[model samples]
Target: MTAPTLFHVAILRTLLIVAALVALESNRLEAAAPEPTQKIASAAAAFLDTLDDTQRGKVSFAFNDAAQRIRWSNLPVSMAEHRGLRMGDLKANQRDAVMNLLATTLSKMGYEKVVGIVESDEVLRKQSPKGAPPFGRDEYFISFLGKPSATEPWMIQFGGHHLALNITIAGEQGVLTPSLIAVQPAKFTLDGKTIRPMGRETDKALELVQALTDEQRKQAILGSQMRDLVLGPGHDGETIQPEGLKTSTLNEAQRKLLLELIAEWSGIIHDTAATAKLNEIKANLADTWFAWSGPLEAGKAYFRIQGPTVIIEYAPQRLGGDVTMHIHSMFRDPTNDYGKKFAGK
Candidate 1:
């Protein structure tokens, strides 16, 4: 071949720069400890060690138990009656250990968000009528599916009214899906500061919707009005025909907003797993879809982000007097909910 020209040299230099950037991103995603799986497994085992035989028997379940896998809801404990060790029944130290395990499993913001959801229940409890269903942070329950192990598949089920966190762990992987995160009186005061449990979720969604062009907005809005989540609790192992504006059609700026919106849910898991899961979602962003229902400018609305590996929905409850005050949302992976892909279930 003839000697390379100046144009060829310039092209080669540009390609090398792009390759370096790709390698840098890959390293960032893989930078966590070799195994967050082991850390979480150990924390779980430590939590179990704090329990007595009776507590252990009540808190543990067969990993593949179909019923337990689907036994989570957004209703209050008095109405739905969750299975597992009630946080209210645990000793103070045991409760602390439970919190420790939760902190270990979720990202810092995620842990704060989960705590805020639980605390929001207390706020609702005070405002609820005397005959309303019971509500309180203490009513939350925690259970383990199968024994905690670094190399084996298992899960953590923790939830109460308006919250359900189903985290599955297998090896270096962590999964959070089929989770129900809701809150009544969505805004409240805690320690003289305002706390909105699902604040980022709502704000980011609205920002993304508003950023779209009028034509794009038309494509994003669904044909039907969605008053509540279509794939909320009890709708496990279900798939819906993808609807709304395809991510492929979005401009670069709009797509970035979409990923930020997705991170509000997927980022709740531990950093190691969340980074990997996000990278996976980003890789498939072109195939994802974003659907919205109800108001496009503000107030209460419903939105969804769906892709090959993930499904997320946010809906404001209509039963509550002010729709904005009560919100219900879901995050799920159609292919890997409960880590079934890793567990071979």
Candidate 2:
């Protein structure tokens, strides 16, 4: 039998959140000495115990019994209001503790992406809200992992409004790749500088598309009329036919640029885990594909990068009110998403 768990209430809750986000087997968890969820749950509980009641509630996962130790959900793309509770609403110490809890669990789960996110969070906290803060204030969500480790991939669901970062780390040497990152700024202007939330993604994608010759471009643009990013959340590697672009169609230079474009965004984690994935992508460089739709300019557009395992897509959504062109982009591995994607022959 397992040792009686030793953790505080909030920590237990948070660990459970991570556990729910991740799919795990108890037997496997026990084999990994200390256990991921148990360890993370212990750490999170310690953190919650350190918090005041108000602070605990602020950063707590707002959900019902559906909130399991490994299935707590929180990452919503739209910037909706009343995203349960928020760490932003917590006190300074409490907020720090909340973030610290996340970072610590990330490390335990063998996901290094949180290091950069942790550092970025500090900077964001200090920097004045970028213009209108991209999306609504209450558009973010938070979930934790009760137990997470390389053996069992557990994650924390936290995003919304101008944010999307679903971190899932599992297996012996798996790294943390933020599943989604999106933002819609009312307009660019951060500290007098033109600042776009995903300028890097836009510029790189545009550059790669422009690099294609007239003939090569046509080969990729299967459709003429532009619309939305066909490959949205519900459609993860759905169409088996491999529509849009193919890397083989491009010349040597164009192909290299395609790699660079995708790599640029993947570089966000800035950790060993990212490097490992990078090496794998580099090896599979040849058998990849790149596709785009709409005018090369920055209005409405859609682009996709697909490889044997890696797939990244970007598209500008309709913005009727304020944002004339919004962005929706994502990266996923066919067989490695959340380390659990089924494909029956």
Candidate 3:
């Protein structure tokens, strides 16, 4: 080609610079955009691909099937009580795929808590009451509601004895509520380390409750005992009158303690979603109430925090009058369980 004139060369340089600037702006826009849920959708698809036809049939459920969505329980699969594909039935590869799916939805801490709860069941199996059905890590089940999609609503239901995680995703938002995490032999020795899956939950609440003055404790303590969560599985969309000491009455230090307790549950979801949920709860702190039952000792008491958007309960199972070793806890959003906000329910 012939050499360009000075004017033409200047114009060409200007166009090239403009194009380079445009490309950089485009890259910046792409990076700043919110991440799509396609990663989770792809992970779910991969997990399903690992399943055989029969397993897939068992694992998948209709999204609108209210009965199936609420069919989860805190009973071991050995009891033949839950409906879904059992981890015990899966091969190593299939199990890994299922875990990969969980990693996509739960934060690193959330995923670790789940695995810890499942492993704790093995301890329960060894310490079981005579002839009390089998309990172990393999007893957990994984189920899906609707087809996984980045732009559509779907849910992942995974639970077993002492654990339930119900995660609903719609567009860019995810809700993890109406979830249960508990432990039998609430504290146990594993690999020479004492593990307490629900320890932060139990200890943190106890700290807050104990910090209250005798007068404050009187206001915070409930007259009636809470044997189980009022809004546990199958108790969807229910509301309870706010009770006990209101956050408005708490001093700044005490309010901080309460927020930390709430984080034990809300922080279980991925960081972005958890931050959003925590912000919502914090905004309504003045209207929130903390109620307590039983003794103030860790692992032995029952307590709940209720607010406009959140309800969390920690109850120790009282089978045969034995309460200290077994526990049950739930976290729920009264306004948005199962992504009701996005579903327009």
Candidate 4:
């Protein structure tokens, strides 16, 4: 072969080799993505099976891994509205047993926060709109990536109507923030009781905004209140910016309030690990932005706190089937988007 021709062939070979390496890495990353429901669904089903016949009876006829994708509206966990999978279904004693089951599952998953929120939900569900189902009655699906457990690295996600919790344990350097928590009240009544769900989380956020000396309010409030969470379902992993609120301008009091606001938000997590994540968010609070829109009232308003540590959003919507008020909220982590297992950054 000619000398020039030989050099050209070598160049082509190098390009092919580079392309091949890129393709291989891309495929590997794709495979590393998380798969939650399928992995834990069987175990969830088995756990349900282990329940005594009486306990199983408390579960909605529709409850099970197979029913993971039911229409959000057709939720079965709400008892009075859908008339299934509720505390009433369980004898008082069995209710605690049910908690035990959930706790076991979380331990098996290597995190108790999973059950912590469940317990919190149980409280909220009791206060669900009369003639309606449990709050966040939608399925609690579990997903996973590589099984690093709490030891190596892994992610487990549990979400529904008003809750979005993602725990990414990447060795000891893990992140459970960027978490989301939401609650809704129909007409502001709870569990046939008049309690308010999320009232504290919401109140604290506004209190912090209000405490901001008048000038700080102008920066923190960020225009008008929103009618709904600006970033909704399909908008997942999409962040909004030049980010209206920044922690840069705030008084010592306002900064403390910011931590207070985050504290209220993080209080929902039932696990120490989740709480530790909240504290990290608190520690990084100054690096985050607190933004709210609309009237910060019980009716017709929305808010969000987005920063390096966590993203919390609150929205009000028309009640489903009943006239009670509605709310949709979520918490997402900065580094934990999708899952950090394969996310090299």
Q: How accurate is candidate 1 locally (lDDT)?
A: 0.89
- TM-score sort, best first: 1, 3, 2, 4
1-345: candidate 3 lDDT, tens digit per residue? 988899999999999999999999866654543463667878899999998899999999988878888888776666647888988989999999999988878888888888778888898788778878779888888999888877678899999888889899876788998899887877788899988777888888888988888899999998645556777776887888877898788988999999999998998887788889999999999899999987768767778899989999988888736687788889999888887887554
What would the per-residue lDDT of candidate 2 be over residues 208-262, giving only the tens digit for each residue?
Answer: 8788778878877767555565544446446444666567777788766877777
At residue 269, candidate 1 shows an lDDT of: 93
Best by lDDT: 1
In candidate 2, position 262 carries an lDDT of 77
Q: What ranges in model 3 sit over 4 Å off? A: 1-33, 78-80, 224-226, 320-322
- Which sections of candidate 4 miss by over 4 Å? 1-98, 101-159, 169-180, 186-194, 296-300, 319-324, 338-345
Q: In terms of TM-score, which candidate is strongest?
A: 1
TM-score of decoy 4: 0.57
lDDT of 3: 0.84
lDDT string for model 1 (56-144, tens) is 99999999988988899988887886999999999998999999999999999899999999898999888889998888889999999
Candidates' lDDT values, in order?
0.89, 0.54, 0.84, 0.51
Error of 2 at 119 (Å): 15
